[model samples]
Target: MNALEKLKILGESAKYDLCNYVSPNLETYASGKIPGVYNSTSPDGHCMPLFKVLMTNKCSNDCKYCMNHSNRKFERYEYEPAELSRVFMDYYNKRYVEGLFLSSGVFKDIDSSMEKQVEVARILRDYGYDGYIHLKILPGTSYDLIKRAMSLADRVSVNIEAATPDGFEELTTTKNFKTDILKRMKWISRLSNDKNMAPSGQTTQFIVGAADESDEDILKRTNWLLDKFKIKRSYFSAFTPLENTPLENYESPHPKRTSRLYQADFLLSYYGFSFDELVFDENGNIETEVDPKYSFAMNNMDLFPVEVNEASYDELIRVPGIGMVSAERIITLRKRGLKIGKLEDLKNLGVAVKRAEPFVKLNKSYQSVLSF
Candidate 1:
């Protein structure tokens, strides 16, 4: 196939990985200067169309839910290192994209597949192209290659795919959850620190609801990864059954469930939430219809209504709609002896006072706005 045809097939094939790392372009987003989707920042800072493609779709592993798994019958394509570099440059030079997100299916072994990806990156850098490049570290790739890949790429990642070992085995027989995937994550974490490379740091993805994994299970693993390995980011790709794949007959996971997962992740990472606070149903599932932050607040009612004028910064973030910025504003105003006079004052200061109403106490007496 020609380069365009290969790009079409490979790009379509790549749409499933569901890993997102692009920083938002807030300035022109409302006016529509940037593309709505697939736009991200390079490790070096340009924010626009990120050229995301897989090196190859051929695979050695049979991930049951995956469209490109080994046993799945489908036409495949491969991009030689030189061909990929030229194609990427064609797009880059024309200003079609500002960064590259390169990933691949493991065709032979980890090192070989990873090497092809590395060469694409090396070729880009060698051509004096210094935009952002995000590369995926295949399972079982060597430490030396890991170090090398990090050196040439702006950001690198090894997808945990499944949070736990046994859960991972249910999806693919070819990969050992710890031996192949987790071990590589450990290597990247160590190498990233020692070399000070991939300044955007490392990230991982979880295939949510695949292998019957619970939302709670995903959160626990995410917490552990953040605490133990310091993974820069974790992405969730809610399972969507593909035609002809082993899981084709299964139900696709809810998109709102995936959204709720992001909210829960934010609460834990930024809002100082613990697993104990996020109420899970009997089946270990988080509530799909509600935002996890609001749900967590509902469960811990006594903690609220937070006295906005008196609550600490940590306490304010836990209140449903009071974000970091508004919390800081409230704190600064309070430090200046500016008492938050009314709901309008809170709103003027940028608090989402509507959501915060039930959770925050009025500056006056024990009665809160929620009481009204």
Candidate 2:
């Protein structure tokens, strides 16, 4: 097959991996825009720039959940390191892409595949290409390779795929629950803590709906990674079963659940909600109807009517509609002796008080039995 045909096949195969869609930053250029926001102009500029390319399609490991496993009977293609680099540079030069997000099947072994993956990034950097590069670290790849990959690429990831050990075992028979995958994440996390390691930190992707793991299990593991490793992001992907994979018959997660998980993750990392606070009941799933923040507010009604002028940061964050930005706004406005009487007052100040009123009280009372 030609390069475009090979890319079509490879990219089609990779669509099952959901992290490919999430944009980390919102400051991306609209198509055909010129002079492109210079990288140095704004630190937050070009956050979601598409890093599009797949290096190879051959594999050796038979991960049951993956479409490109070694034993799968399909036409396979492999791009030499130089060929892959050229395709990436061509796109980069044309300004159609900002960077390269590359991954490959385990062509020979984990280490060899990782080494070749690192070579692509190395070649890019050696030629003075300075845009974002996200590399996927294969499981069982050595620490040396991990370090080398980190040095060359701006960001890296190792897929944890399943939340629990039992779920993990059921999905990929070739993967070891004991050491192979999680260890790689731990190593990357450690390297990220080093001051000089890399500007962008480590990230991981979990395949939702592939197994019977609950939202509670997912959130708990996500929290552990955030607390233990300070990971930059924990991506939750809705499992999309492929043509011949073992999970092809399994149903994909309800998109609502996936979205809720993203919100819950944001609450854990940015908002002050704890794991226990986010889960609805003993079973550990979030309420599908109400969001985690609203659920928390409704469940703990007694905590409502907190004086907007007096509530601490933690308490204010619990209020619905009052995100970190608005919460801080309330704190600052209160200090200035501003009387936050009406919901309109908040609206005028750009605070989303609709969700915040159920949990907080303003200085002046609105006509309602509930607090402002």
Candidate 3:
């Protein structure tokens, strides 16, 4: 097949893996703007840029949720080590991309497949290609192979597709539970902490709505991963059923629910909210109408109207709309001794006080009462 045809077949087959990383534009940076200073039409639109790409779509495992599994009758293709390196370099040379994100479907056994991935990365590095490279470290691979892969790639990931042991067994039938996946994550975590290791760090993806797992179960596992492994990020892919797969008839998760889980993950990482606080009931599913922060404020009415000047950082973060940035601003601005008589004062400093008022006290007065 031609290059275009090969790309079509490869990209189509790889889409079922559900890994996504979007690149950012550097228009503001070109003008010599300082880092962390973002220019956006709206205040909330500021974020750093990234670049992402898939590596290959060949596999030996029969993951039920994956379209490129060995049992599935789909067109298969594998980019040779040199060909993959050339493609990435071509993109980089033309300034069409910023980095390479390489993942595969286990074309051979874990060791051989991982070796091939490392070979591609080695070629790029030897050619002096300096850009971000995120590689997927397959489960059951040797510790030595993982170490080698980590040495060349900037970021590494191992997906734990299911939340529970039974859920993992149901999805990927042949893999061992804790021994194969969790053990590798533990090793990666250890390696990342070492000062000489790659600086970008490690991340993982969990397939939501593929099996019978509540949001609470997923968040609980995420908390465990973060505490135990010091993971940089945990990605949640809303499970999309593929044709001819065993789970083709399964119901997919609502997109809004997936978005809320990401929001909840942020709350857990930065705002000190527990998985239990984000959930409405014992099952741990977030309310669909509002995000978890708003839900938390509405439920804990007793904590509202906290004094902005005197409230501690922990207390300020619990408020419905106040994020880490706004909380710091509130603390810093209060020290200036400005006469903050009303909620509108926060608007000048770019704080969303409309959402904060119900949960904050201004100048020792509870200006707004919680409705629920």
Candidate 4:
């Protein structure tokens, strides 16, 4: 196929990887955004637009939840390293993209597939193109190959793909939960930020809902991964069943599960929240109707109305709508002898006052204003 034809097929195939996406609500961004224009935050916290696509969609593994799994029937496509590199350079030169996110469905073997992806990063660098690149490390790839890819890339990931090994075992026949995936994660952690290695560190994704795992199940693993590996971040992809896959008849998960997971992940990674403090319903899942922060605030009603002038950084962030930046701003302003006895003053400091009103004591009369 020609470049245009390859772009059409390969581009559609790669949408399943939501590594660059923080939210699935693209309808809100659909009108303003165009193809290959994805806003992904980098390791240093700069949100950069990426040119995301797959090296190939041809796979040998039949993960039941994957759209591009081997059992699925479709027009398979692969991009030669040179062809993809040239295409990416064209886009980069035109300023159509700021960086690249390259992933692939495992084809012949883990080594060959990973080499192909690393070659793309290598080729771009050979062309004197220095831009941000995030490469996906195939499960079971060797450390030598990983080291080579890490040298050329800013960040790399090995997709955990499921919440737990046993849960993943039920979803796929070929993958070994203990050896193939986790061992590779350990290798990445061992080599992170080493000489000529990926300075940004490692990240992994877990497919939600596909393995019949709850948000709590995902959170526990997320917390452990964060605390143990000191990994950069986690990405969540809600299980969307595709036709021709084994799970085609399975119901598509709500976006709220993805959204709530992101909220809880931030609370775990950034704000100081424990798994016990998460407000899960009887089903052992987070409440999809409310943001996890709001749910936590409701569950801890006795802790509400925290005095804005006195609440610590952690305490301020625990409230419904106050973010870390805003919380810090409140503290900075208070230290400047700014008495924040009113809602307007807090709002001026960047707090989402409406969301914070019920949870904070702006003043004794502030809570009564909304009767909230």
Best by lDDT: 4
Q: Give the local distance difference test score of model 1.
A: 0.80
lDDT of 2 by residue, 301-363 (tens): 778867776788788788777777777887888888876777787776666766666666666
TM per model? 0.92, 0.88, 0.88, 0.93
**What's the C-alpha lDDT at position 133 in model 2?**
80
Give the C-alpha miss distance for residue 124 in model 2, angstroms.
0.5
| Model 3: pairs clashing at backbone N, Cα or C within 3 Å | 23-50, 24-49, 24-50, 305-359, 305-360, 305-361, 306-360, 306-361
| Cα lDDT of model 1 by residue, 1-372, tens digit | 887778877776666554444322121221123221255544355556767788999989888888888988889889999998998898888887777888899887878999999999888899999878889888888999989999988789888888788789888888888878888888888877855578778888888877878888889999999988888888888788888888888887776777787788878887888878887889888888778888888888878787887899999989888888899998998889879768888889888777888887766444454533
Instruction: State the lDDT of candidate 4 residue by residue for 315-350, as single tens digits.
Output: 999988799889899888878987687888888888
> Which candidate has the top score in TM-score?
4
Q: Candidate 3: where is the Cα deviation over 4 Å?
A: 12-51, 369-372
Q: On TM-score, who's better, 2 or 4?
A: 4
lDDT of 2 at 23: 38
Which is superior by TM-score, 1 or 4?
Answer: 4
Error of 2 at 139 (Å): 0.8
Candidate lDDT scores, in order, read 0.80, 0.73, 0.72, 0.81
Off by over 4 Å in 2: 18-47, 364-372
